[model samples]
Target: MKIKTLAIALCLFSLPFAASANPTLLEKTRQEQQIQKTHNAEREAGFKLTEKEVRAKRNALIAERNRLQRETELLSKSFSKNENKLAKLEEQLRLETGSLGELFGVVRQAAKELDTEMAFSVTGADHSNYDAVVNEIVAAKALPSITQLNGLWLGMTEQIQASTELRQVSVPFINGEGHQSVVQAYRLGSMGLIADQGYISWDGKRHVATPYLKQPENGPSVSVMSQLNESGLQAVVVDPSRGVMLEQLANSPELKDRIEHGGVVGKIILGLLAVGAVIALFRGVKLMMIRQQIKAQLKNPTKPGNNPLGRVLNVYSKAQNRSVEALELRLLETIVDEQQGLEKGLSMLKLLAALAPMLGLLGTVTGMIETFQVITQFGNGDPTVMAGGISMALVTTVLGLVSAMPLLLAHNVLSTQADNIRNILEKQGISLVAEQAEKAGSAA
Candidate 1:
């Protein structure tokens, strides 16, 4: 009976313990299974969301692609429309080509038919009208190119018709000054106009338009000169020895009459200038004379008042007994006087020398003016006409320099001699006074 009770009690304790463990284990297993289910649901939801977003993005991309396709189609259509417009323009140009050419031809013909006289009556016809004509020819589209030949022919035809009408209407010749000229120019024929001014060809070569003035078999030759008229327009005979045609004319007898008159006037003016030059040179001559007198004094020691040095020596001789202070004062006075004399007219000489250059400059100006005048009267057709003025200009400059150089040398030499004489006078005066003092003191 005791063993059975013990066994039953042990069984009862074990049952409670097992029952508590069972509930706890059940709760743990339920928690773990619930967590697993929750995780699986979350994973499925995430995957579904990802698929949804991907599908949405794909749909958006498809819509965008459709929109781009529509834009591309519209752009292509626009390009086709532009191409059609260009094609239409090109076709129109092709169809109008003939008509435009015919129109240009008619315009050209009308331009040719209209006389310059009629155009003048209409007024405002000039180079601008000609340019319009040329433009019309250019735009004709008849030929592949509006060649120079075609232009020449068209220009000639128009000019002939216009000139003929102008001649009939008594039109005046036009000059550069906007006035009528006396000389009448016809065509560039051998008989009518002498020659057109030769032009530089396309290859930079000179092309003489007129065949009448042919080169001599040997070379170019000039004719003898005749005198020029006061107007400077007459054909003066020229010396054949001269190289150029204009030079011969300039040296012509007719030109010489005017030039000689001018030369005489120039000479008269130059004579006055020469008188002034003489006056100026007188200063130099005086200096030379003074120097010569000094030399003469040295050659003949007996001569009095010949040079500053001699004068100083004479003064010292006369005042040998004087005190050094007095002697020095006298020497200083003598030196002042001598210096004044030596420098006499030097200022005037310098002024004259300076004026020489100025005169030369004046000559240059006058010469250049003359050359420019010739150029203005005629043209730069001849260099020979200009050489005389150039020569005069250069000669004047040379003369100026030649005059100045000698004057400069003379001034330097005179200055050096003056200083030398002054020094000698001073030294001699000092010695003479000092010697006299010593002699007097010793005698006393």
Candidate 2:
């Protein structure tokens, strides 16, 4: 009974310990639940305030949008009123300007034409104020003021005066070697640019110096034009056609350029020319040597081995000092033999001269044939298409003539030298024979 009473006392003390360990089962649980409920209520009230704030912001945006629309509408109405006012002002301007409107249009059109002309003209490029004034006048709804018109007139007058006047200026140019150099440039009455190097011209935007393709005969004379630009006393030949002639010349082919189109025929002609030149040179040197030896033999008359005259003298010496008639016969025989040697290559040279032109003719025929072939294949629509064949024909013919003339001249010269040598030997031998005959007569 005492233990049961102790157990009941322990149970009563343990109830408070259990409640302290588990707050959920005690008064603390009830207090925590109440705090949670109050927090939930506060959160619900905060969310409602947030929703109201968002709706208020949306309404503010809508009001701002409506305000902006009203401002746009007001601006459009103002713009319309101003546009009407501008139209009325422009109409009044037209009435006030009267005939000036047509004049303004005419002035603008002239300015446009002038701008184009000046841009292409051989003068300074990029018109500054002139361009702006032209644009303003073109876009204008009314007639220009007097000052604007005056400026336009003055600009045109200045351009006119400048076009006729010569001006010298320094500019960069590209030479033949593709190097840039600063050269003195002359503005030749707004038609072309003349420079020290060759020809100069405006490339629409900037002045560029370009050389003539087929340089004019006095092409470089234009370079001396620098002096013309600087001094009045300088005398020089002037090309009135300026770049026009040069451009045309550039299209025309030169001899060397023409030879290029002659094809194999031209090559053959050149080969023949080279061979003829070699023959002429050889004959010249050989004949020159023979002439010198003949001169020495005429003076000495002792050794007659190396030269024609010496050989003739040797024939006379081996004549057993025979009768005048017999020695004369031997002299004639020796002269005949020497003459053959002296005139060795002359005939061949003459033949070469004759054949060169014939070969050229052959080339011409072949070239014509080729040209006709081209005509057969394609009608004569473009000259360039048949240029090669035509060039070959003409070039070969020219080459042949060029080669032939020189060869002919050389042949004539060599032949004349040989004939002179033969004549000298003949004269000297005859004189020697007569002298011997006179001595024999005196002894007899």
Candidate 3:
């Protein structure tokens, strides 16, 4: 039994060795279970890692969506701001294109016209903003502001007011000889632009004062325009029509020109005046001498026939023997012959005085006809051609009137003197004839 028990223990020990030779089912299953447990643990660990990765991806998606939403909001705000800006811009465009645009057009037009006016206007030339303002206005797209409009108004008003005023300025002058000089220019409104009594033209491109070809005799004399005061000049000359009217007046023919233009008719009138004056002088001298002789002869009645009264008395004495009727006839014949001598040259003087005016009229008619002829040929275009004839007409008329008045006065004086002498002779002859008749009666 002990052996049997030992063998059984051996067998038990050997059986454990024999079983260790091949894996036990429980051990294999445990091993398989351990491997499965390891696989499961590894899978769970991998799944937990995958879950962390999945969470990270989900968080990234959420973050991306949130960022997209924020960007959308910002874009909407930007669109809203852009729309408001466009609405305001449209309103501004409407305002600019409205009546304000028309007003700008009017202002620009006025500025342009005013600029031209100021260029020729003497009064406001020194204070004009014409060129700069015109350029500014031309480039502008919008209406001018109140300040700009006020400047325009002032420019226009000042120009108008300045044109009416007289002001002096410094200027460069060009003479007829093409010489240039500086001067204190005078602007006498519309009358003339003068400096040192010479006219200047403003219509030319060069702003140079120019002298007339023939200056006026009565220039802007110091006597005409008072001497300049200490404060400023009293007056100046300005050219409205440039130098048209004043130049024509200055170029008008003078007295020397008149004689030249008056031609032959004018000379004839002058000759008559001269002859009438000479004859008057001669007649006056002759009458004075005759009166002296007659007055002396009256003192001594015996003095023979030197003067008219003396001759008549002598004739009556010589006719003493004849009857009263015969004696009267002889006295009448002698008085008539003496009257002829006293009235000598008086008729000629009167004729010349009357003829002078008629001749002048004839000359004037001829001059007018000549002027018309020139007009017909030249279409009245040249004033210079017409001026000569006009001058002739005026001069001849003036000459005729001047000659006639003096000649008429001279003839009247001589006639009155001759009449007085004739009356005296007649009275003396009558007295002498009556004495002779009385003597005859007494003798009978």
Candidate 4:
């Protein structure tokens, strides 16, 4: 009974502690539930704020879409209205411009044709101010005014009148040397301009006349111009093709230009020719003198002089004591020595004659190579590109032929003279030996 009472007491005593523990656990549970409630309230508030913002953005987007649709509808209606107005205006324009349109078209076409013709016309050089009227007609968007039509007719009339009239006028001129000056020039009725110097070409764009680089043989001269000015009825040469033939004459190469085109080989060939000519002249003069000396010696063989035949006679005199065979050998040797002096420059002349043509051939080969290279680089489309090389080849060949001919002629003449001298020496030597042999035999 006492133990049970103690246990009951202990239970009673533990009841307050258990009650305190329950209160503590209840406070903790309440604190945890308060934290969870605060988190849920904060999450709900944030969701409501995001929803409001999204709703506002959606409303704004809906308004923007409506505004864009309204603007698109307005633009479409305006485009349709503008298209209808443009079609109406075009119909009205078509109805109002019926035959006038054709007339304007004809005028424009005539203006275009006239502009093209006038660009190449020599008369345009003096009447260049008419270009503005022509351009106005060509570029006119509407029908030409009566004034413009009259201006066009006036331009055509001026061209016709200029084509028929031969007049002299002071104009700006550029010479072949590229000097610009104001000079008195004769206008040959749209044919060409003739300055005091020569034929001058018209530059319609620059409104100036330029002289031809090389004037034609029968071209205008100062005497002809003077007569024309004095009489106004002189027969003067005119280019019927306006400037075509004149331009060709101006571009034609001169002799010096052709020589330059032959390049270094041509110069060398000419140099060789000069050298050969000098050699031939010297040798020819020397041979002539020697021949005269030999003739003199032939006239007076007994009196030996200071010459080839004289020396030979002296040898014959000295060798008279020797046998006939030995004397004959000695005379032959002396003739050979004279022959060597006579034949001095003949071989060099011959060599120069031979080498000139060979050098010309080398130039031809090099020029052809250059031509082929040009063709390879630029193709054979333009013939002028290849003309340089072709000119070089032909000019070099001509030079070669020219150089070789005279040298060859000189060589032949010189060789013949030397041969004649040698023959004379041989005959004289034989005669002297024969005379010596006859004397020796008589003495024996």
TM-score of every candidate: 0.34, 0.57, 0.58, 0.69
lDDT of each: 0.53, 0.79, 0.77, 0.88
RMSD of each: 20.8, 14.9, 32.8, 9.5
Question: Model 4 misses residue 251 by how many Å?
Answer: 2.9
Clashing pairs in 2: 196-223, 304-310
- List candidate 2 stretches off by more than 4 Å: 1-116, 124-152, 164-189, 193-198, 205-242, 252-255, 261-263, 285-289, 292-296, 299-305, 321-333, 373-378, 424-444
Quote the lDDT for 286 in model 1.
Answer: 69
Could you tell me which residue pairs clash in candidate 3?
186-237, 187-236, 187-237, 187-238, 188-236, 188-237, 188-238
TM-score head-to-head 2 vs 4, winner: 4
Q: Residue by residue across 1-444, what tens digits does model 4's lDDT show?
A: 999999999998997787687998767778999999999999999999999999999999999999999999999999999999999998999899878889999999989988876887777766655778988999999889998998888888888888987677788877667788998877778888777777877776777777766777877965687787788787777779987997787577888888899999989999999999999999999999999999999899999999899999999989989999999999999999999999999999999999999999999999999999999999999999999999888889999999999999999999999999999989999999999999999999
* TM-score for candidate 2: 0.57
- lDDT value, residue 85 of candidate 2: 100
Best by lDDT: 4
Q: Which candidate do you rate higher for lDDT, 1 or 3?
A: 3
Rank candidates, TM-score, best first. Answer: 4, 3, 2, 1
Worst 10 residues of 4 by lDDT: 122-131
Question: Model 1 reaches what TM-score against the true structure?
Answer: 0.34
C-alpha RMSD of candidate 2:
14.9
User: Of 1 and 2, which scores higher on TM-score?
Assistant: 2
Which should have the higher lDDT, number 1 or number 4?
Answer: 4
